[model samples]
Target: MKNKIIAEKSGVIDVVIIGAGAAGLSAALFLVRARRSTIIFDAGSKRISSSKNIHELLGFENKSPEEFHNLGEKEIVKYGGDIRKEKVLKIEAISNNLFAVQSTNSFVTAKTVVIATGLIDVIPEIPGLKEGWGKDIHVCPCFTGYELHNKKVVVFGLQDRIGQLSKFLTAWTNNVTVVTNQPFAPTWIKKLSAVDVQVINSEVASVIRSNGKLKGVITSDGQKISCDAIFVSTSMQASSNLASTLCKVDEFGFAETDAVGQTSRPGLWVIGNANDPIGHLAHAIASGTKVGPMVTDYLLEYSLADLIK
Candidate 1:
């Protein structure tokens, strides 16, 4: 079907979506299919781009993040959704519940705004850890643990979380070890012991890599522990501050939203990792799908009010 682009007298678009990740593209697909004039601002380099292959997401399993996003963008464009490769610098609430979206080189007005800006994983400052990120070093094993099944796995970082993560890794591998000097409560230690996970009380000074591959880790006490994969319970923060500017955000700058991605500010929505830091690819896709109808209904009511006026 040909796109029924909504043309407003004031040149306002039906929706302006920021961040062309899975959630943003998914939302744009729905809006364009619903005959809304949608524009997506894509600031390149999504959080998941670091992963060589995406897992757990059905159909796109083992596909590169770049490939998934490329296909998603194509589908949106096929539906007459305008996708721009520009970073949205700021968003202002203009009169009449419209929004002014400002990017690096373009500006536009929109009836509603959707922020799909994902979160950033704060990796521990261990030497060489960043070099092996998304490959040998990861924040969570839920998505990639199967690949490391029966292989030696190491867990570290965050005094409160390492114990639990170490224990969880046992489900995928019996050779689970946690490296941390920080003291854990007796219960946590007992839990790790019950799971047959090893605990090493030492600070990881650096990762041991050879020829661009992770070999193991070197502790501050000069202890070398070998592992096929390492999981760090790192902190996370929202990638963009735009949501914080327009809605109620937590300390990490994640927008506080309703179940359907509606922020405290009407006409503004936050989904994906911008709202739920721990949301995976599937969750992001589901979030975008859930918010599409809500946004469409909001536009319908808005158009009716304008007609009455």
Candidate 2:
């Protein structure tokens, strides 16, 4: 299929999933298998697309993000779920038990809604770093460690977790350098110096590049060192605007949900990166897997009770 972008509005689906990432697809797969009318509206912004391979996922190692979504979509459709390539611009609760989701092309009303939209990585402001991003410069070592085997790598830390990340990256390469934009690193970093990962304390001014590839890092003092790649560890902001508009968010800006992923709103639910703290693919899928059945059962039971009354 060439990935159709249809603007035609279908009637209200039973459940409207706001994203098509791992979480949304997993939930759709479970819900459709239970014979519920489900529709997935994908904004098409999966962070894993830049990843060369997905790691630590059970039964799926070294698979690209495109491949993962392709298989997932096929499975979901086979179970009678509808997938739409549309972005959800706004969502609001029309009644006590209904939601109205608005998109660029169409609008949908659903008895239940799942906000699985993920987070966005705010990369560091460094020249040439953006160009090499998702290629030589990586964010998640779990996804790119194998590809970085035996290469000269640099890990940039915006927080205190760099020492731990430096230790993790050392598993893939011998020549690892941890850079903190300060005069001295923490005591733990100095203790780990025996692992052969050099800790550089300098304010990074820019990323040096040659021939459209990453060469090294340029410090504020006008010194440069040649390296093969760089990995940046920084905080991310959740892409939860639609969720926040409809319901209350937690202190961390994530959609607040109960044990079963039910939000403060009765018919609104949140899963995946919109609610998770770590935002890993496996964790997102697990959240969806658990929430899908719970929401389905809730809707079915409520419908039955209404019929009996």
Model 2, position 308, has a per-residue lDDT of: 95
Span of 10 residues, lowest total lDDT, candidate 1: 1-10
Candidate 2: residue pairs that collide: none
Where model 1 places Cα greater than 4 Å from the true spot, the runs are: 1-6
Note the residue pairs that clash in candidate 1: none
Q: Candidate 2 lDDT, tens digit per residue, 1-309?
A: 332222226455678888999889988888888777788999786877776777878878877879889999998887777788988898878864778888878788888898888887778878887787788888877777887897998887565777778888888999888777654456766656778888777767889877987889888778787788888887777776887777788655688788667888877888987787576889889988998888788788757877998
CA displacement after TM-score superposition, residue 268 of candidate 2 (Å): 1.9
- On lDDT, the leading prediction is 1
TM-score of each: 0.96, 0.89
Q: 48 in model 1: Cα distance from truth in Å?
A: 1.2
Tell me how candidate 1 scores on lDDT: 0.89
